[model samples]
Target: MSWTHTFTNLCDWYTHLLHNSPTGTIHIHILRNTITSNPDNVEHILKTRFDNYPKGKPFSTILDDRLGKGIFNVDGDYWKFQRKMASLELGSVVIRSYAFETVMDEIQTRLIPVMASKAHGENGTEIKTVLDLQDILRRFSFDINCKLSFGLDPGCLLPSLPVSNLADAFDLTSKLSAERAMNVSPMIWKMKRFFNVGSEKKLREAVNVVSNSANEIIKQRREMGFATRKDLLSRFMGLINNDDIYLRDIVISFLLAGRDTIAAGLTGFFSLLSKNPRVEEMIRKELNQVLGPDQESPTFDQLRQMHYLNATVHESLRLFPPVQFDSKHAEEDDVLPDGTIVKKGSRVTYHPYAMGRMKKIWGPDCLEFNPERWLKDGLFVQQDPFKYPVFQAGPRVCLGKDLALMNMKSVVAALVPRFDIRVVEPHHEPQFVPGLTTTFRGGLPVKVIEKKMLST
Candidate 1:
């Protein structure tokens, strides 16, 4: 059976149980507990009663083992400290410029070359089984993020697709995260820890690999200093004396946050663009119109000016949100509008993926891939962050929103004009691969026809 089938069956069962349960949260047979997919309830739980919910032990323990005490696993002051540090570094103009240029460099220098070779060698035939566009994209993102976060590029996008010791660490780490997310037996979890099980051993090794790499990068940055570049690594290195654990937390935090989320977003965007030629054409037209005929790398202003492209991105995100579901634990007892009381220690889930499908919030045509909903009267209308929930909402919204947009726009701007993409298999259907982020299950295979340049 397909992966989507398994997920759907699981969702169906979970939805049914949550639908009948009196409380907003229900302990699942697989996962420890799940919070129902209610918009208002999600808002209240995540925003209004935000203080009540922390990341929680069940969620924390598994990820903590691999990620260490990073922001994703930690709550309260540690999360706040890490979040502040990341924002200060990531939110800067110089850092943003570096991020945009670095990603473009990868696309032009690394990514497009791979596709170009494939297209040329295939003799115009469809490049069947891109295998894992998500993986390739992951490599690209990881490489760029390394440059941004560590001031050193790991070069994961090399010609041979060399094994990334760091990427491999992330692989094992995320696998354990998924296993733990399903709420494995605590007794088993403890016993595994006690006995030093294979999985646990693997988890520790992965964490050590990541930590050692991060520490080396930290050490390197301190020695060299940020005399010229104003990258994130420089910023962290400047404040290394603030607290060693805090510095470690920030590196791992950005590492986890940057790697998969943007790749997932781009994977969905490219998959949809392949199937929907009109969307691709519109995006290209907008890029040309806003960026001029030369097809230059988009500036921050030009990136913002390509409103339709942004909408296309938003629409894609609506359908395939990277973090499909976000979980939080209620700190104090609360009552949801559905009359489902959430106990103080109960878990809550907000399904942005499911919310995009809900006819009530997203209107009647929720499932349709229409960027027009995000555009109003021929102009792109920025929707409330709450309604979209793609980058998330409220205080904990994604810090890398601007950076993600800038990088995505850069790639699309670079490639779309030069190539016409055709989805090779199962046109119009999105295959779901559930990981830390949702990606196309079999990889998005598309035939690329080098676009004929018009004589001006």
Candidate 2:
């Protein structure tokens, strides 16, 4: 199968492997050599046999031109330092105050309206496709990252095609990032770059777009004598003085981490909700129960109380993990539990999508989209992080997990209760497109209706 086709239908491939492979392990050489379908092996490769694995030169080379020495694309000391810096900056009170508020406002004011408008028309029939849901979420995340990181809102959230170079750049940058990530050889990557082949030109253009955009944010922040602002840029400025590369690296890293994943996540959640009426009804019921009959804008604490809402989100993520497949390099030769010897330079992947559907892991109802599986007795039950691995397992787990959940909770709480979403005509079955993040082949299209609660 073509790599592009694999990108879209990897889940089906996993299903095939699960049924056919005698031992649930396969050594496949396609886009890259991958070992998957064995959780014990996946765990051993990531944890017990970790030292044998590093991200390796091939992975680094593909991301080097655009990401520089940022955390996601780098390993060893560089990664450790970036990770430390990110943890500290994200933990600060300034980001907690203004950054989250900025994100919340964008979701409330910008994203919801765009979605609601697209679901309807003057004629009252569904406009369908709503191609802009993913687009709007990406812009929302980009704008949030811009403001939180630089004290500058790129205003990509404004009702229009994104005018800012940064916003436009991120759009293509993420796409190229996926393309480069799939290539297995350093020489092949160099060849691709040397000939301006494959997604190389697009990646380079995106790099320029993101670099210039970051530079502008930095320049403007400095020009304003940014002592008054306590956002992430100002904090980073405190760390490294006027080094442009440092500034650019931080901005791009934030952009890379923040964008696309949440968009894909939101896409999956809503898509699942569209198909699964019981899950949607239960979530909506929890919203009403927690927020009360007349409540519109729910507070954070109120959001936390919606147990079924959380379960629905969890189940959706289980079936369709945002980061579907993740790779770990075996640092040295090591034996996986299934007796497969992972060579020192081998790239091994754990497919969370496959894990979620594993009857052994989640029971015979694994393929069913049932949110209650997460609940025990009358309340929600939290699954083991290692077992689930949606936000990933071990030390390199996602940083934005809490914020992403909070953001998702807020959006779903506000939108799901207030609007009844229905899939629009000739309904396209949701298909996975795998790269860095899992996304649908075409965007999900749903018609939403404003729900009428009992008389106030």
Candidate 3:
């Protein structure tokens, strides 16, 4: 279902379909898809029989031009090698500290100041600043991801709010590449690519812009000697054997992981906060207990103790997962845990966006934004990875999971007490853009007011 037809209610439509199904799984023979929102089916496909499901050639080919041999676009050894390298680097204390310090600095110096400048009223008036929070968060995340991946700042979040060619190109490429998959037939987009025309041409140009920029960064990292650097590109360079193209792919993969997902998550989190003032109050109370009002700057350790803040982020993700539905092609004919028989070479999709709304999995109040569901005795509790596959599960789980969470929490911790963000239209459901990430259309327009001014 296209956005034009369903008004971007595809996820909800799928949820309705799954709810009506006896086993919570449906096979569309025309699409050769086995779409499921069932936890048991998800667990079987994602973890129990992991090898039976892979990215497969069909899925990988769609992203190959932009992602190259990057982890997300591959299976087997390519995926395994990148995963191992990323795991080791991410698991390191140095990298974790590096990420925390980078996030803290960026939030304090760039993100806060930008929002503060926007929040100031003209001539001391009480008028609030109107901002596209989604756009701002994406810019904020792009800057941070550049630093994390290449140890460079593109100044995407500067007061001037300059447009970044690299970021823009990457976004276009992701959107168009995903467009290829949404076509009714693979031949349609593939033929367009063969003829080099229309949207495919635009996709090619955008990918070239992104690929060229990534290569330049890789070259600079090489000339500068990556042995001493702690950034992701450097660490990857040290691990991979002097293949600059491969290095570019690695860095680009990290860029994709770093930029959009966190921005989407935070955008949804604040939008929900605007609707649920009580949740906002509870978060502030938890923050007050953890970090005194006078203590403005939060340390990494202080952020860790913010269990409610963590829960709020989780709740937001459950409602608006960045990558709504993920698909894995079955390597062979297999019977799912739900007793649905998946044919060989069929796409097995687990719908996280739909699953989040399923009453069967989350009880009667599943549709509501309730952070307390994730809390037991005021401490955040983990859900089964299959049930909450937001960051994925098993061997291919997101390597940057912790870093993403820390940055998201850091942003909220820094700004929530200082400013208030209210969505211009809280009652309206967001129309999602057709892309690899769940980006809302119209960029989430909101009025931001300084908390001190609000208090007055």
Maximum-lDDT candidate: 3
Q: lDDT by residue for model 2 over 1-456, one digit each (tens)? A: 563355447566765676466666667755445656676776665666555666777677666777787777778887787778878877666666665677678877887776665554334554444453555666777777767666677788776755777676676676677776655655665677789867777788778877876788788777777677767777777676758786678667776666666777877787778778788777777777777877677776676777787888888899878887777776667777877666767777777877787877788998888988888775888997756888875667777777777777777877776676665633565676545777666666566665643344
- Model 2 lDDT on a 0 to 1 scale: 0.71
Pairs with steric clashes in candidate 3: none
* Segments in model 1 whose C-alpha atoms lie over 4 Å from true places: 1-34, 120-131, 427-434, 453-456
Lowest-scoring 10 consecutive residues by lDDT in candidate 2? 121-130
Give lDDT tens digits, candidate 3, residues 229-318: 888988888777658898888789888988989998999889889999899888888888888868987788888899999999999999
TM-score of each prediction: 0.89, 0.89, 0.96
User: Which candidate would rank higher by lDDT, 1 or 3?
Assistant: 3
Which residue pairs clash in candidate 2? Answer: 51-331, 52-330, 52-331, 52-332, 53-329, 53-330, 53-331
The lDDT, on a scale of 0 to 1, for candidate 3 is 0.88
- How well does candidate 3 match the true structure in TM-score terms? 0.96
Root-mean-square deviation of every model:
3.4, 3.2, 2.1
C-alpha positional error of residue 237 in candidate 1 after TM-score superposition, expressed in Å: 2.4
Off by over 4 Å in 2: 2-8, 29-32, 119-132, 161-165, 183-186, 425-427, 452-456
